[model samples]
Target: MSGIYIHIPFCKQACHYCDFHFSTNLKKKEEMVLALAKEIEMRKSEFQDEIVQTIYFGGGTPSILQIADLRFLIDEVYLNYKVVENPEITVEANPDDLTENRIIELSKNKVNRLSIGIQSFFEDDLKMMNRAHNVEEAKKCLEIATQYFDNISIDLIYGVPEMSNEKWLQDIETALSFDVPHISSYALTVEPKTALHSFIQKGIIPQPDDEVAQEHFHILVDKLSENGFIHYELSNFGKENYFSKNNSSYWLGKKYIGIGPSAHSYDGKNRGWNVSNNSLYIKSIQENKLPIEIEILTKTDRYNEYIMTGLRTIWGVSLERIEQEFGKTYLDYLNQQAAKFIEDHLLFVDDNILRTTKKGKFLSDGIASDLFLLNLE
Candidate 1:
């Protein structure tokens, strides 16, 4: 089954550590929504025979849209695309935008899941991230949202500068108190060109310590595991039957259509991304042309991707699939490259499935990179 990802590229305010494509301007919001709907309609044939199982509204802030705007887009998908009867439609919302009424409205309009950007429950942490919500609003929204939605996920940030281990644990505890099914926690990263990066460069804010972040990650894994949550991915924790279908589809390399500015789409062979500019995206779509760049995946490229994504999830890379699909040469190359890591206890082959050991989980990306085949022609 395929999925659809709609990127809403507008935010109420910019977060300090965010580098995602978005605009603080709302003037083009209406035009952007229309463009998004058109893009969905235009790309219908891309997934003509496939049934859509998930529709994700991710963004600068999807909750910034009015109910009518959201309904319009959802209805557009239903009308033009082949979707399942009960597709998992998720909307990524900020705590500040999820009012009591808003939660109810979203439920009525086919949005079965809510991924709230709580970030942190502490006021100082919120301010440090320049989040739009305060401590009370974060807690209040979850209190209200949990009443209306069962399949809810909240994002939390750990390893902020000056945020002690005690505070991080408190954040985890507060999130657990909500009884939500899923939690997507990430370390506070200092992306280049972001306000946080600038602050660190100017010595106004301290840089994030890798040791501190690693410590927080372990704490998160231990706490979530103790509370009946599965550490399904490096950054995601979910209860049984509560994993994010949309993101899971993506990690499994299922084909998906991404609509709107700066969105990425993939078929089995080609990957494409929309232009990052809002006005340009709208203008191009209005002209019946897609504002996207495309890349055709080579066999080596696909194998590398499989290794990268597979290593990060609970389902580790399959050696049989590798040999079958990528041929014996690629499989041998993988085994050869991974031999050292396996011997070091960073990775292991169990039942022909290559997976990272607990000691290698945090460094899975680096290990996966080391196994990549370069310049395969």
Candidate 2:
């Protein structure tokens, strides 16, 4: 089963730490929405009759769009794709947009899940991040949204400077109190060219400390585990059966198509990405062409991808599968590379499955990078 992802590239305001492709200007709202709907229709044949089991609306805050606009996009999908009978449709939303009327309208559409962006519960943290929503809106919106949607996942940010341990605990406690089904918490990183990067460079804001971030991560694991929330993914916690199907598929290396400016697509062999510029994307589509870039994955690229994604999840990389897919030579190389990590207790190797230890999870990216194999051109 394949998945479809729609990107909405507009936001009310830019978050200081975010580097995702988006525009804060509302001048082209209607044009972008209409173009997005057109893009969906245009890309219908890309998946080629594969049963679409999941559809996701991720963005610059998908909840910012009007209900009618969303309905039009959903209708277009239904008209074009052979979507599954019980497909999981998700929309990424912001706290300020989840009004009672809005929630009611969203429930009426095909959206069965909401990934609310509630980065933090502290007013100062919100202000520091230049988020559009306040602490009260962040707290109240989830409660109101629960009336209409049960498959809700909320986002939280950690590692922000001045985000006290007590405050972080309170944030998690508040989210837990709301009984949200799923939570995606991430550490804040200063990406280059972002406002946060500039602020830190100019000493306008304090930089996040590595030790503090590590401490917060441990705190998150302890509290969520005590509260019966499974740490399914490193950044995601879920209660009951509320894990995100769309995101899970991606991590598992399933095929998916992404539509809209700056969106990405992967087919287990090749990856494609739309042009990041909105006007160029729309104009190209208007002229009957897809303004996108494509890259064909080589053997080593595929193997390294498997190592990176598979090692991070509960499903570890399987030696037998690697030998079967890539060859014994590649498997031998992996075994040789992983020897030191296993010896250091950072990786656990048992029953042909290789997974990161709790300690290794913190340095997963670095470990994965070290394990990457470069293809000689």
Candidate 3:
């Protein structure tokens, strides 16, 4: 089954570390929403034979939109595609926008899942990151969201400069306190051109240390596992049957269509992304144009992509599938490259599926790259 991802590229304010395509300007909000619907219907032919199983509203901040606007966009998907009866409709929300009234209204909609961006429960961390919501809003949103939505996920940021291990643990503990079924956490990386990067360069804020991030990750895993959460993906944990169906499809290399500016789409063979500029996207889509660029995947490209995503999840790289799909030559090269990591106990093969050891889960990305085939055609 395929999925449709609609990118809402608008935010109340820009976060320090976010580099995603978005504008704080609400001037084009009405235009963009309509454009997104048009784009959804415009791309229906692409998924003519595919059934959509998930409808994900990811964004600059999807929660920033009105319930009516969101429902209108979702209805466009239904009009254009063959959607599953009970599709997992998820909205990535920010705490400030999800007031009790808002949450109650949202629960009445088709959206069944809420991925709240709590980031942290600490006031200092929230200020450091320039989050729009304060600590109380974050806590309050979760308290109310849980009452309405059973499938809720909260994001927590770790490895912030000056954030102690004690503080990080507290963040995890605080998240557990909310009883969110899923938690998606990530280390704070200073992406170039972002405020965080500028702050680090000017000595305003210290650079986020990778070593600290690694420690926090382990702590997060151990704590959540103890609380009955499964570390199903590298940056995601969910209780049984609570894994993110939309995101899991991406990692599993399933077909998905991404709508709106800066959104990406992958149809088994080709990958495409729309133009990042909002005005450009709307103009083109309105003029019966699809502002997207596409590139067909080569065998090596597909193999490398699978290796990167596969090792990051519970379902490891399948050796037998590799040989059957990519051929024995690629399989042999993978085994040859993985030898040292296996020897170091960083990776292990079980039932012919290669997965990372607990010691190596944090380093899976690096290991996956070493196994990449360069000129093996």
Candidate 4:
């Protein structure tokens, strides 16, 4: 089944390290919401024959919108698309927005899941990241949210400069104490043009060490694994039956439509994305034009994507399927390229599936790039 992703482009404030397409201005939020709904309706024919199994509201912060606004967008999806019964609807929220009444409202709505952005439960980390919420809001939101929702996921960041392994452990422990069913954690990378990068360049803040991030990842894996969490994806750990259906669909290369500026869509053969400029996107959609661009994936593009996603998840690259889909020639190239990593014990082929070893998990993306077929076979 396919899924629908709605991107909200407005934020209360900018995070220091983020470079994602968003605006801190609130003046256009109401108009933007309408444009998003219109885009949803406009793209119905793209998935006219498919059934939607998940509806994900992601953004600068989806919870910034009122529950009524969220419901209106969701209802538009239901009104236009052929949605499955009991679709998994997810909203990416921040702690500051999850008030007691907000949690109650969200729990009673079609939103069945929340991916809270509690990047760290420490005042210093919060300040460094410029997260709108504080440490107390992080813990308090989880306490109240857990009471209302069972399918909850929280975000954490690792390898912040000056954050020791012990401090990282405490962060994980605090999250564990709340018994969140899923967690998505990532290394604190400095993207060019972001405040974090500028800080590092100016010697205001030290760069996040890759070695420290690797150490933190292993700690995360071991701790969560011991607590009955499955390392379902590279950065995602979920308890049984709690894996993110919305995100899992993307890794598996299923069809999905993304609504709003800077959102992306992918079918098996082609990928599309909306304009990154919010005003342009809204204006185009309002004029009944889709402000998007599409590219047809080459065979090489598809194969490379499969390798990148395959190595990062529990489901490894299927050798037989590779041969079946892209032919034995591409399969042969993959086998030849993977031999060195396999010999290094960083990757292995088991029962026709190629998977990364625990040692190689942190470097899966790098390894996948090595396995990528640059010239068409």
lDDT of 1 at 280: 93
Error of 4 at 165 (Å): 0.8
lDDT of 2 by residue, 1-377 (tens): 88989999999999999999998887878988878878888888787758889999998878889989888888888888898998999999998998888888899888999999999888889999999999889878888898889899999999989888998999889889988889899999999999999999999999999889988998998998898888777788888788888988988899998989999999999999999988998888888788889999998989998998887777878999999999988888888899999999889987999899988887777788888888633
Candidate 2 TM-score over all chains jointly: 0.98
Which pairs of residues collide in candidate 4? none
Judged by whole-model lDDT over C-alpha atoms, candidate 1 comes out at 0.93
Better of 2 and 4 by lDDT: 4
- Measured on C-alpha atoms, candidate 3 has an lDDT of 0.95
lDDT of 1 by residue, 1-377 (tens): 99999999999999999999999999999999999999999999998899999999999899999999998999999998889988999999998898898888888888999999999988888999999999999999999999989999999998899888898999999999999999999889889999999999999999998889889888999999999998888899999999999999988999999999999999989999999999999999999999999999999899999999999989999999999998999989999999999999999999999999888888899999999999678
Ten-residue region with minimum lDDT total, candidate 1: 101-110
lDDT, model 2, position 205: 97
- Please give the CA lDDT of all the candidate structures: 0.93, 0.88, 0.95, 0.95
Q: What number of backbone clashes does candidate 4 have, counting pairs of residues 3 or more apart or in separate chains? A: 0
Question: What CA RMSD would you report for each candidate?
Answer: 0.8, 1.2, 0.6, 0.7
lDDT, candidate 4, equals 0.95
